[model samples]
Every structure is written in structure tokens, then in C-alpha cells.
Target: MPGSITGTIVDPTGATVAGARVRISHRDQSAEQEALSGDDGQYSLPNVTPGPFQLTITLVGFTTQASSGILRSGENYTVPQIAMPLATAVTEVRVVPSRVEVAEDQIKAQEKQRVLGVVPNFYVSYDHHAVPLAPKQKFELAWKTTVDPVSFGVTGAIAGIQQAQNDFSGYGQGAQGYGKRFGASYANFLASTYIGGAILPSLLKQDPRYFYKGAGSKRSRVLYAIANSVICKGDNGHWQANYSSILGSLAAGGISNLYYPAKNRDGAELTFENTLIGISESAAVNLLQEFFIRKLTRNIPNYEPVSP
Candidate 1:
């Protein structure tokens, strides 16, 4: 049955507010009928189908108001008076930020993720469905990793160990030798991280982050971890060959020839060998990420459990 709804708009001071737009929406059908208050602040919506309905009232220079009620067949229902307060002077600073900003926010969250509150574990995405990072964001993450204070500390420690073991005798001993070895170690780190994690991934449109797999059988999880070394999610959200990781290792190994001692410089065979080793290292890291890292890592987002 069809019915009618009537209402009046008023201000807090009880003065009638005319020209207020009113919308009566049927709750079930998601249909709406609209009218405007007359000079006397009266509004009437006729031929409205019987149903539970909501009324939204709006006017210039006044806060919006809402009223709700029910209408019966052939009924002329009068809604309670709708009040329109003085419109809020809201300076809506709507800054529609870019995708890069959104990606940066996620990166900032990942940067805070540390294992045992110490080591940065920023490359693993607990969010399996995380947005693909932009190319610049990929570089930023690699740069952030390379320049972290912890990275320097770790590299220095490695240099100290190499010095103790009398490795890389070409650099000789003393403070100068330590300095040289440190430079070499840091160079290797920079090459590997930017090449593999940033440059190649950006170029190939592949995500450099390892997606964690926390909800699967042990054997399947292990297999997933190992397979991740050679397969990765592309920016298009499809799993594909991880050309970025595989080739980046080879590229980094090739670049090592420019700085490392002649004996340390990897030739063609050695470069391939290093690439294989890098892949193995990646599998091991992914295994740790899947089983152990998240447990130790702080600030991991609450992610829905996913099967491999």
C-alpha cells in the first residue's frame, strides 16, 4: 500500500527552517523518495510504499539531521520535527594521498619490525596480500637496509672476524687493513642488496618481500619456503619466475670483480656458483621467516592465516 510522510525542519531556537531537502529511504528496497520543505518548513512525501523508512534532512548553513519511522498502508505519518543546527565550519583538509604514500606507510610499519627487538627483519611481509610497492619504494627499502646503524655494526663485526682469521691477506694488517676489509664488506653488502632487492625487482616488476606462510603442514611449508627462492609474486599479483632474485645475485657477483681482490673476484663459473649459494641462502632465510622469524619479530601486523 502507498502512504505519505510529512515533517518540519526547525532550528534550536524553534524557528522553522524552510527549503531543507528531505530524503525518505525505504530500508528494505534501498529505494528513496525526496522532497523539500516549503516556506513554512513543511515537507510531504506522498505515494511512498509501505515500509520502514529513514529520513535525511539537509540545508545550506545547517548541520544535517536524520529521522526514522514506519508507515502503514494508506497512512499519513507525521515524523518528529527535524532540527538543523548551525553548520559546522569544518575545514576538511581532504588530502587524497598517492599510492606511494600508502606504500610508504606500509614500509614504515615494516621498518619497525625487528627480531628479538634487535635485528631488522624488514623484507618479509606478514601481509600475504600486501600492496605491491612502487619502484622508488623498493629502492628506499634497500637504501634503508644498507644504511641502518645495525647494518654498519654487523659489517664491522664481520670485518673484525675476518681480520682475526687472517682472511684477505691482500689488505694486510693493522687499522688500515681493518678499514679496507670493512670497505670491501660494505661494498659487497651494498651491491647485493640494491642489485637483488631493489634494482632488479623494480625492473622486473616483482615484489622483493618474502610473503610469510604460517598456516600449513610442516612439509608443505618447507616446500613453499624452498620454492620461494626461485618463484615470486609479480606486481600483477601472479606467482612467476623470480628473475629478479636469481639474476640480481649473478649481477652482484659480477660487480664484485670491480672491487674485490684479484683472488676474491668471482669469474664466470664462480659467479654462477655464488648465485646458487645466494638462492640457497634465500631458501634458508625464508624457512626461518616461515617458522621462527615472526615469533621473534616485533610489530608484525595481525595477518589472517593462509595455507601454502
Candidate 2:
């Protein structure tokens, strides 16, 4: 025989837990019952015959509970107070970071590194796909390099070397000749850099900076960088003829005739020839940049292969 069982459920705060499911069961040949707690957390299994029985309670996001006890026939069973512990909470967090953006930031930092800490060396890209600089950025680079204190120092040194070598004897000797040589050399640097690196690059939609290909077989990378002297990335991001560099060399050479001694003047044919010499000189410099400059450069970020 069996009797009735009843009970209430509550949280630690003593709030009534409504809608909690309760189960009453007996062993083999047993019966079962279910009910939701009322506002008072009270529930009952009505008209149950007395016998050994099991009680269970369950809720979502909470642990399940059960107990067993005996009930005598025609008796009423009052269950002990039921308390459920709060379920443990699980939290998750995710983070995504930008590698390309970080690389660009590093390049900006390296742009400040200068030869002997004064000459601007802003044109080398330490990362692939280094963002294309705006026209203003191109002009800014040329301006800074042209006006650098070290630029003036190097110009003076070169004039001294030429004076010693008597390379441009046409300019004569003594202080006047040295002044003329210095002015001519500096002017040549200014005209060529501004025209090639800023003015013509802006007008012709070309990028004046060198894109370093630091990978591939030695021969391939060498060829790629050398070819860049003649073929450049345009502002459109495509490789095209380097007309900016070519025309800039010619313009600088032609302008030089104005300052060189009259006896050393290159007629139209000689001006064009000197322009070709400038292009070849650029090719040699580009080769050094690809093969050697990175080793001497101090502030470049350590090279890391990009992930696929």
C-alpha cells in the first residue's frame, strides 16, 4: 500500500521556484506522478498509496536531484526542504588581429631610419604590398631627402672628391671652382629626385618607390629587382614602363648643361647619351639595393614568411 507525499523547493535566497518539475516513483510494479511547484514552491502527489518511493526534481541549466524513502500505508509524507545550487556559468571570448595593418605600421616606423641618421631612406618597402603612398607622400619623401643635412654633407664631400681627382677640370680650381661644382651637383640631385620621385610620379600615375621581392631563388629575385629599375609599379598597382625615371634622368642631364663649363657642354646628342648613362647608373644602384642594402640597414623588422 502507498500514501501521499508533498514538498516545496526553493533557492538559497528563499524565492519560490515555480514550474519546477517533480517526479514520484516506486520500484517494480510502481506508479509515477509529476507536478509543478505553485507560487509557494509547494507541490503534491495526490492519492498515492503508501510504499517505498523515489522523488526527483529537474530544471534547465540546473543539476538534477533524486532521493528514496519509505512510506507506510495510509500515511502522509512530508519531504524535507529541497534546495538546488545555482548552475555554474561558462563564458567564452574570441579575438582577431590584423597582420597586414601591423606590417604597415612597422614600415612606417622603419621609414624614419636614415643612412648615418640623417639622409632620408623612405623608398624601400620592407613588406610586400606595402600600401601605395599618396602623391603628397611621394613629394614629402623627396622633399625631406633633398633638404636633409646629410644630403648637403654628402654633396660637399663629392665636390671635394671631384676637385681632388680633377674630374671636372672645366670648372677650374680654387674656392670659386669648388663652389660651382658643389652647386651643380646639388642642383642635379634636386632636379632628378623631385622630378623622378615626386613630380613626374604624381603626374604619370607611377609609384617611385622600390618594391623589394625578398623571396624566390637568388637569381630570380635578383632579376626581378633589377628589372624594376626599368619597369615600375604604377599608381594603378600594375607593372609598367618606368617613364618617370627615364624622363627624369633626361631632364636632369639637360639641365646640367646650364651650369657645367661651356667647354664641357654636351650638345643635344651628348645630353641624350648622358641620360642613358644615368639609367644604367640607376640599374647598378637598384642591384645593390636588392643584394646588399638590407644587410646594412639597421632598423628593418626581422623577415618572417607570410602564412598561406
For each candidate, what is the lDDT?
0.84, 0.74
lDDT of residue 30 for candidate 2: 48
Error at 207, model 1, angstroms:
0.5
Task: TM-score for candidate 2, please give it.
Answer: 0.62
Q: Candidate 1: lDDT of 117?
A: 87
Q: Lowest summed-lDDT stretch of 10 residues in model 1? A: 91-100
Give lDDT for model 2: 0.74
lDDT per residue for candidate 2 within 1-308, as digits (tens), equals: 34678888887687878778999875423457888888898988888845456788877755566666656545688999887556667432323223334434644665776645555567776554444566777787788778878789999999999899986789889998899899999999999999998999999988788776666677887777678878888765568999999999888888888888888777889878877777777778777777777666656655432210
Shift of residue 98 alpha carbon in model 2, Å: 16
Off by over 4 Å in 2: 1-110, 115-120, 302-308
User: For residues 1-308, could you state the per-residue lDDT of candidate 1 as single tens digits?
Assistant: 57799878889898998899999775334468899999899999989876457788888888877776657556799998877888778733334445467568878899999999889999988766566899999999999999999999999999999999988887889999999899989998998899889999998999999988787699999999999999999887679999988888888788878877777566799889878988999999899998988889998777654553
